[model samples]
Structures are given as C-alpha cells and as structure tokens.
Target: MAKKNSATKLFVLDTNVLMHDPSSIFRFEEHDIYLPMVTLEELDNNKKGVSEVARNARQTSRNLEEIIGTNEESLEKGRSLGIKGNTHVTGKLFLQTTALPHDLPMLAGSKADNQILGIVSYLKNIHPDRQVILVSKDINIRIKARALGIAAEDYFNDKVLEDTEMLYTGITELPEDFWEKHSKDMESWQENGRMFYRLTGPMCPNFSVNEFIFYEFDKPFHAIVRKISGKTATLEIIKDFINGKHNIWGINARNREQNFALNLLMDPDIDFVTLLGQAGTGKTLLTLAAGLAQTLDKKIYNEIIMTRVTVPVGEDIGFLPGTEEEKMTPWMGALEDNLDVLNKTDEEAGEWGRAATQDLIRSR
Candidate 1:
C-alpha cells in the first residue's frame, strides 16, 4: 500500500466497468485509479471475441500499455496518467504489482469479482485517510462491496443524464395562454404550400430548431421550429399525417406523437431522425411506412434497407444456415409483420395485387 493525499481519491475499477467503457480510466480527472491483477486477467480473457466488450477490453489493454510505456520501475511506483495531449488526466494509475491479503470471507461464485473486492478492502484498510471507492457496472458487485462496508459507485461517465426525466423528448407542449403571450407581434406567411409563423416572446429563446411544439386547446396547433435567431423562432405547420388524406404509404399517424414523428420522417430537408419509444409505440411501423413511401412512391430513395442487431433473448439457436438475407429473416419478423399491414392498406388492391406489392417492397 502507498500513502496518498487526502484530496485525491483512489478508484478501484471493476472488469465490467472497463469492458463497458474503455475510456473510463481517463474520465476520472484528477483522481487516481487502481486496477487489480484479477481485473487485468478478466480483460485479457474477454479480449478474444469480436463483440463490443471484447473490442473495449483490447482497447483498454492498449491504453494501459501506452500509459505504462517501457518503464518497469514506474509499474511498481504507479505511472502518471497525464499523457502529453490529455492534460485533464492529472492522476496516477496504480496496477496491483503485488497481491494484498484481506481477511474477507470467500464468495461462492466469480473468483475475479471476489479478488477485486478483496483488493478494494485491503486498499481501504491501508489508505484510511483517503477515499477508496469501487466503481463497477454490475449491481450485484456494488451490493456485495457495500455489504462489506466498502464504498461502491456505478461508473457514471457513460451516462448521458443522471435522471432519464431530464432527457430531451423532441417535443414540448405550449401553455394554454401561449397564443395570448406570443401573438402580439407574430408574423405569418406561406412557403411551398406550408404555413409558417414567426413569433417572438419569452418562450422563443427556449425553443430549439426541429423540436415539435403543440397546443391541444380550443384550436389545436402542431408545428415544428424551423429556424431560431436571437429572440425569434420560425415555426412551420407540420403535415397532418393523422388525416387519412395525408397518410404515408397507406399508413396514417395514429396519435399526436406519431404525427410529429411522421412529419420529421417525411421531411426532405432533415437528413437524420431518431425515434425512441416502447415496443408497441408504432416506431417500427411508422418508420417502415415512411421509408416505403419515399423509396417506392416518391422515388427519392433507390432502396430501403432494414437491419437490426440479431441478439437472441434466450439460449443461442446455434449457427443459422442461410445466406446473409436468409439468416437475417428470422430477426426481421417485425419488419415482415409491418409490411403485411402496409400491404393490406390498399382496399382497391386485390389479394394478388397486395402480394405483388409486398414482393416489390421486399425486393427494394
């Protein structure tokens, strides 16, 4: 054990933390990091596969090698993590060169986890004046560490927001008196058959471009911010995809959220769009409908390629026997189901016509 300053805390990183985010080592600015030998062993064991975890493990090994360099003496004394370009990382990285003994009880499973816990316990004993915390992604490991009175915390650098409620939903609801507050100097016009409004008020500065805003009061208003400059924002009336006449490839938006999503998806100016919702929220269905409309009807896109990560929920089904498309067929059951629904939207198209349309959609 080595003596440390009271201001600098020592963070003992678990194998899962490194596997989750390789750059986590550099993220703890001005705080020292200690890596147990068991953690290194686990990283080595996980570095063989082509999965993201394996790739991150390999990258962590590379980062360690870069930090450790060719100085064997520094390995025992701890290496300064303040590399030339990364001035923010002003702490040293300590690797377990020699094992520290602990009197903790033996755990039944996961020897690596137990060994890491033991190392944290030993470090806490030696560095009583300094804070020694265990950073792990596994909840069970955190619980075990806490049960033993060892300070434990989840690696939070990878989290985009501490509270998910603070996340941007890409939509905002206007107050009931929105018109009365902002309609004083509001300017209105039309461009390309789309209605546009320029408004300046206390709320104008808070509005972000492309963020949907709606009012469901006496007169429903749904629009998207097109431009924002100074204290003024230009809002364009979004297409009413919920109306049957404005359906996208035989699919109409079922609700206000879906209408906003379709407005973004169907827009030609927006190059990228992301949809986040629960399983039955029509994300896939709406996306497929918009893609089909653009690719097949509008002829703006040459093809629609649909693919998703083929992660099985349960036991592995073993190697699937087929070409690339055939292997992916099982994973695309949702896509197939959505296409069936889209194909049936045309009542005028007979069964044979629907089947032919489905074939065309699949081919593209």
Candidate 2:
C-alpha cells in the first residue's frame, strides 16, 4: 500500500458527500476540492424535497453559492473557497467545465455513479504530481472508485468517532492504588440516605458530572462523580444492586459495571439515562427490568415508553399488516425476550400467571 502524503491533496466530492454535510467543503482545511458537473446536477435534482436529504441538498447549494459569490477568481483558474467569515480555507475550489479524456464500459442507461467515477479518473490523470482522491458517503461508489484505480475515502467529518473503539463508555477505571494516593484530603458524609465523598487530586480535573469511576482493590469500589469544584470532586457511591434486598425484577447485578448501571437506571432523580454496551452484556435486560419495576411495581411513573432504532439484524421482513405497536413488534424481539425472563422469576406465577404478567407488561 502507498503511504498517504501529509501535503495538500485534491479531493473530488460526490453529491452524497456534500448532502451529508454542507460544511464538508470547508472541513478539508488546506486541501483543494473538485466538483463534477454531474454532481451539481444531482444536487439540484434532490434540493426540492421536504426530507432530511432534501434539506441538506438545499443547504449545500446555499453554501456553494456563498463560497462562489465571495471569490472573484475565474471558474477555469479555480476560486478560493474561503470567504470573509471563514478565512481558514487556504485551498481553491474547481468546477469541471471541460470534457475528460476517458471512457468506461458502456452501461444500459445514464448512471450517475459511472459519471462520478469517470470524473475521479480524469482528476487523478491530470494531477499526476499531487494525490487526487474521491470522497463519498456511498459504499458502492467508493468500491467502484477503487476498482477503477482511484483512491477513495469516506466523508469522516460528520462521523462521531473515527473508530468505534474511541466511543466514550461513561465509566472510567482508576488505578488500583488510586484511592491510596488521592484520599489525603478526602471528605466523607451521608446526605439524605446517599453517601458522598470529596477527594482532591490531579485526576479531579478529568472527571465529569455523572461519570462513573471505580477503583479495584480487594473489592471494587464504584461511584459516580456528582459534582466537581476545582481540584475537589464529590462522588456518590453507587448502590449495591446485587444485594438480595435491592434486586430489580428478581435480577441481581453480576458485576460492578452492571451495578453502577442499575443505580443510574433506578434513580428517580436522574431524568434521562443512556446505557451503552455490546451484545450479551445485559444492557437491554437491565433497562427493561428497571423500567418494569419502576412503572408497574413502584408506580413511580405512569407508564414506560420504550423505543429503539429499527435497525434490522438479518434480512428485513418487508411490510407487515398490523397497527403501529404490532408493526413495531418484529423490531422489539429483544425487549419481549427480556420480559419473558423477568416474568418467569416468580415461580408462584405458574404458566397461566406468567402469561398474564407478560400480556400486562406488553400492553404497557
């Protein structure tokens, strides 16, 4: 594989890339941008709908107009993308005004994908001294670009994390001897049934409110940072959800992380909570159990409103004939499966009783 140069390179933007983020052109910083005429046509065609893609298309058109309007440079010679407000852009933007010297295997119809690929090939050929790459959000276009010997990349400007592993877990594991070193000016107190501790240390500044931190000693001590004042941080010790007395829906937390999660989930004071975990980590099970216990048993809230991204795991089931809840049933198999486990916790609630409980929970 050829190493990518740190020098300013030319990036050819696909219509989808611009629609994904209107500011993507400026996001390149010092790099130049090339927009194919076909890309502009596609953007114009898509700029007339009410959907999110349409709105993004319109925004991209407006941004392009602003950039072009601010620059007085000729179209053929290229124009500076930077305007008065955004003087950080040091690269120029060019539009494809002339025909390219290439031809692809003829297809049945006039496809936009082929036109974009041809433009990338043309840019790479003309700019032999510099690297010319195609940037798009479409997987198929990127694959086709690579097949045609053009360097292609995804539009990473709008991505939350460059790598999935870099996502914040909300839990920070402190060193085993963390408490020993940081406990010098520690202050402890019990407030309204909850325990709080204040410790001053260099690590205090890195802490954020509602962030879980734990120290591993003979036993794990887990707490959530409730407040931070300069070098001092007040951490509230997470409740022991594993204790038999505090079990929710007959489920005991299996680990420190689970216990901490249960603490957040069951807390009435915490208006909203987000749980993140990989598959088989009991994320859904814990959340469902806590929601049921609070809404059904404790009567803390009127009802539980559960919804999730309807991303299909396998082949989609196409259209289903049912009401809203029924249509959403296929997407909620995990939730239903967890409820079944919770319903079976009470052995006294035999087959018929379990069915009744399941039905009642489902009705909610």
Candidate 3:
C-alpha cells in the first residue's frame, strides 16, 4: 500500500514462482524474500515422482535448505542470502511461522492462493513503511490479488524478451535524404562483379557488419553495410533475389525484408541462421525452402537435420510408437507441410518425381 522507495522491499513468493525458477529468491538483488509455510508444504508435496514439476520441486527444496541451513533462529530473525557463492543477493530471506490475521473475502475460500494473499496483506499491514509485493506465475492468482488490493505481479526474470515486437530485424531503413546528406564524399569501385561504395559520413557509426541498409527516395538503393573504417562505411549492393539470377529454389523474395532474409538464408558462407516471426509469416517455409535448395539441389551441405523444441499441448500422449524419425513425425508436421509447398515448385516433376523428392528428403 505504501509508495515504493529505494529501500529494500519484501517480496512474498508463491510456490509456483519457486518451482518456475529455483534461483528466483536470489534474483531480487536488494529485496527480502518471505516464504509462507504453506508454500513449503506445497513444495514438499510436489517433491515426488519424476516429472519436470517434481524435479523443480526437489530443486526448490534443496535451494531452500542450502539457504536456511541448520539455524532456525536465524530464519526467525532474517537469514542473509548473500552467501559467499552468491554475493549478488544483498538481501535477507524470511520464513513465516506464526499465522497472520486476515480479512479475506469469504468467497476466496481457504486455498493456498487465499493463504498467500492473506500473508501478503498481513505483511503490508505490519511493514507499512516498506513495500510488500507478491510474485507468482499464475494468472488467476495475480487477478485475485489485484482484486483484493494486494500488489502482485508475474515472475519476469525468465522472460527472453519483454516485447517480441521490439526485437531487432537486422535491417535499418535510411532516411529519404540520406544520400543528400552523407554521400558527398562517397567513392565507388567495382570488383569481382560486385559494386562497393565507400561513404564517409555521420552514419558510419550506426553501420555494422552484415546489417542490411536500404533507401527508397528518388533512386532506390538496397545495400548491405559490409565494413566500417573510422568515419567511413563500405556499402555493397545486395544481389536482387527477386527477379535477378539469384532466386533460391524457384522462390523469389517479394519484399525488402524477405530479400534480406533470402540473401542470408541461401548464403553457404553464413553458417548459422536464426529467423524469428509470428505464425503464417513464412519463417518455416522460407527456411525449409532454403535448406532444400542448399542440401538437395546445390549439395552445399551433406544433409539437413530438422529439429524443434518438443513443447507439449495439454496432456502428452505418452510413448509414441515407431522409429526415432517415426516417433518424431508428429512434431515434424510443420516441416512436412512446408515440403508439400516446396514440392509443387517443380510442376513438371510429376507425382512420381515429387514422391521421389519427398522420399529423398525423408531419407536424408
């Protein structure tokens, strides 16, 4: 209820938070962690069996034990988590032993969620000078805490990116007047069938190797920032993958981003390729098409090994039957679907040829 300050605050962690990240308690650099007794009970109850949840529960128990040690007295007062091994945690850990008085709504019931909420309210009421926040991974718990006027939030320490839209696209669009401003002292030369321009300007600092740069004012220009020497940058025109002789496996890029992606994807010199996009954005299709072109057509690589992280939806249908490939067939549905599109690229290649190509791909 109090306005947050620079002083170290108290964070009441839920069982799911600990299970999500066993090292979460230490992630709060200067804040204190308060663990309710019910959270420990939940962790203990879950610390059986061999599932990921069970493993996480066991790890959480171990982490708690290592933090608490053999001193119950220290925990009662407050145990400093800044041990020698983990000097990052400049905070203390507290354990709730005595029951806290609460005025939770009767409809809330006496579940673990309500208990954690009760403890948060109690901590807020007692520690009026400090901020008390509840951290959990459960959406419903967060909603309930907010309804009860308790400050609650999701555990974001494990987030890869706070916003996917903010991810860099490896491309920068130059201003329309870029040439008018920075192309005065530019020098040009042609070598090995590629045109390179040496431009010295204020934009050189913004240039990085392999970053795509394009300008579309008056005369359109599409180039890549190949190198930078002090205040000068070398810009090489990108080989048009659309209509030029650079099409990949009958697939031509339609847009600037797609062109950039195709240039990177089909480059045998570039070993690693990472593509990020939303569904229906042609990420898988483009990657597979490039892969087929390189592996089956050009013989750039011996084989293409397709793999994905096996995240299950709902309850898993345990123990799929078949060979390793057959068992993984369900997960490779996206690859198969994309292959269907790629196979149609060669219309003259009859049904037999398509089937043969599919067989060759699977065999590889």
Candidate 4:
C-alpha cells in the first residue's frame, strides 16, 4: 500500500475505475481526485460500443463533465465542489504531458493503460511526500502496475457480494423399525413444523431418489422434512430426464438463479431461447425428444431453432475451420446422435416425442 494521502489523498482514477463505479471520485470525500487525461480520451473513443458497460461509461463521463464544468474553480481550493452526493472537486488535480508513447496499440497493447501508469510513476517520483495511488477496476492493470513498480489497487466498493453457502448431506439412515423408535415425536414433529433426526456418520447413500430426505440444515441439518410424501417439500429437483421427456438434461435454464432463463424460454411473451450447456448433460437430447413429442405428432412450435458455438474446445474454429456451418456441423452432429438415442427409429410408425420439444418452444 502506498502511504496514505492525509484526508485529501491524491487518487489517480483509472478509466476502468470510473466505468466500474461512476461515483467513485465523490466517494473519497473532499480528496485530491485525479482523473487521468488518457482515461477521459479512451472513454470518448468507446462511445460507440453497443455493450451495456460501454453505454454506462459514456453516460457517466457526460455526467462528470457537467460537474467539472459547474465547479471549475472551487475544485482547485481542495474543498467540497460538486453535487451533494459528489465530493467537492479540486481543479485539474493532475497535469498532462505526452510522457508516454502514442505508438502503443489501443487494446492488445493499450497506450491508455501505459500512459496512466506513466502518469502515476511521474507523480510518485516528483512528489515523494504526497500519497500517489492509482485506482483501477482492472485486475490485470493492477498486476501490470505492480510489475512496473506503480502503487495500484482495485476499486472494491463496486463489487457485489457472493451468495451464502449451505452444506449437503448425501445420506441419512433410520433403523429398521424407524417409526417405532421415533413415534413419540412424530405427532409433534409435523404439528410444530419441526422434524428432528439423529445423525450417524457410519452410512452414506449413493445415487439416490426420494429416500435421500431434504431438510433445512441451518438449525440442525435434521429439523426440516422432505414433504414429497406428506410433509411440505421445501424444493424438489427432477434429477433424471424422463425416457421421452423434454428438457430433462442440461438445465442451463436460469430459474434456479433469478427465475430468468427457463422462464424466458417457457413464457408465451418470449419468442426466442438460446441455451448454452456443457457435454453429456442432455442439452440437445432433451430438446429433440421434446420436439418429437410436441410437433409432428401433435403440432406445437412451427420448428426448432438451434445453434452451436462452432469452435471446438482448445482448437479455434476460425483457423482449422473449413466452411462456417461445415466446421460447426460436427458439433451439432452430437444432436443427431442424441436424436438416435431417442426412439426416433420408428418415427412415422408411432407417436414420436420429438414434437414435444419443438411444439414446446413454439408455445413458449
């Protein structure tokens, strides 16, 4: 860590730090906020990117320009200068010089990043008494800065928290006369919304089904009940793909996340679904089987829309690739193999489940 810059630290805000959290300069509160000139130049250059992140950066820059213009003078006094939420700006807290080479590449060999580094190096060398901190949201930039002997750190306030965790017990066993030993407690168990069980680590359950009871492990890992039979089932996960069922495998659906992906696929309001999943998980097999059941047999969707990433793992499709589709064909060839896995051999002879998936997509 660089020496702390009194209450008014001189912070060189990297382009990425601003993009990650537009309000960062204001966050330091009445500090010497330094915006690298190159950072602004690069943001202006990225105004045309169609990504959400790019749009946000452009918007934030425009907003900042308005603030800097409004408080052009007071910012130099090192006092509160801008909007209420924003800390007072201090005039151009940093000076400019073409100290860095302009010949560096824009991205692959970014001149902006190198220039920001140069500015920090300049400040550190000339103003040894002042705390010169380079704030960047890019992990790689921070690493590169450290490698070049610049004091760099990540802007952590904008980061999101990860979800909490819960432990899983794969197996639970009850003695042969299970109810007899616990009968006295069974009546009050369901009544008081409590289910308690004794844990013995001697046994473990393998490839399981309903027998592996699910419970809320927060209290005791044994207090809750798996209600598939009579109690309330907290949550049920359909593990195996039904023989001819649609969407049984590769559940890349987003419901389990934010009720996002799968719901989008199933909603009549949505007309398109693009799923990406890994191998041996029935990504293709599940859909094809469903299509057969819903479509040709009983009209559902007009047709199925499918696509492949095209590039195989490790090898680049662009370099080794023959024709675009030809290169991608082998990847989808797995879909053909999955179709064979479905009982599609006698398609016209009987009720095929292929229509189920096709019709399902259309209905959604």
The per-candidate count of clashes, in order, stands at 0, 0, 0, 26
Best by lDDT: 1
Error (Å) of candidate 1 at residue 288 is: 1.5
Backbone clashes in model 1, listed as residue pairs? none
Candidate closest to the true structure, highest TM-score: 1
| Candidate 1 per-residue lDDT over residues 1-364, each given as its tens digit | 4576889999999999999998889888898999999899999999998899999999999999999998858466688888847798888899998867744665655477887888899998887889999999999989999999999999888677756578799999999999998998899999889899999888989999899999999999999999998889999999999899998878888899999999999997898999987789999999998988888889899988776987886987778998998888788888889988888898889899999998877665
Tell me the spans in candidate 2 whose CA falls farther than 4 Å from its real position: 1-6, 20-23, 45-56, 70-92, 97-130, 137-150, 159-163, 347-363
- Regions of model 4 farther than 4 Å from truth: 1-33, 44-60, 66-69, 76-115, 122-144, 153-278, 287-304, 307-331, 344-364
**lDDT, candidate 2, at 203:** 91
Provide the global lDDT of candidate 1 against the true structure: 0.88
TM-scores of the models, in the order given: 0.82, 0.79, 0.80, 0.44
For each candidate in the order shown, give its overall lDDT on alpha carbons: 0.88, 0.84, 0.83, 0.52
**Which regions of candidate 3 deviate over 4 angstroms?**
1-7, 68-73, 76-89, 97-110, 160-163, 184-192, 197-201, 207-209, 227-234, 278-280, 309-334, 347-356
Q: lDDT tens string, model 2, 129-238?
A: 78889999999889888887889999887776646578777889998778777899789999999899999998998998989998777887789999999989999988
Reference-based lDDT, residue 211, model 4? 32
Which TM-score value belongs to model 3? Answer: 0.80
> Please, what are the lDDT tens digits per residue for candidate 3 over residues 1-364?
2233538888999999888888888889878889998899999999899888889899888887888888746356677788747898888888876777654765366788888888899888877888789999999989988887889989999889958679877888899878877888789999999899999888888888888898888888998888998989998898888784666766778777788888788777778878776788778887888988988788888988877988777888688988997898888888889898888877789899999988988877
- Higher TM-score: candidate 2 or 3? 3
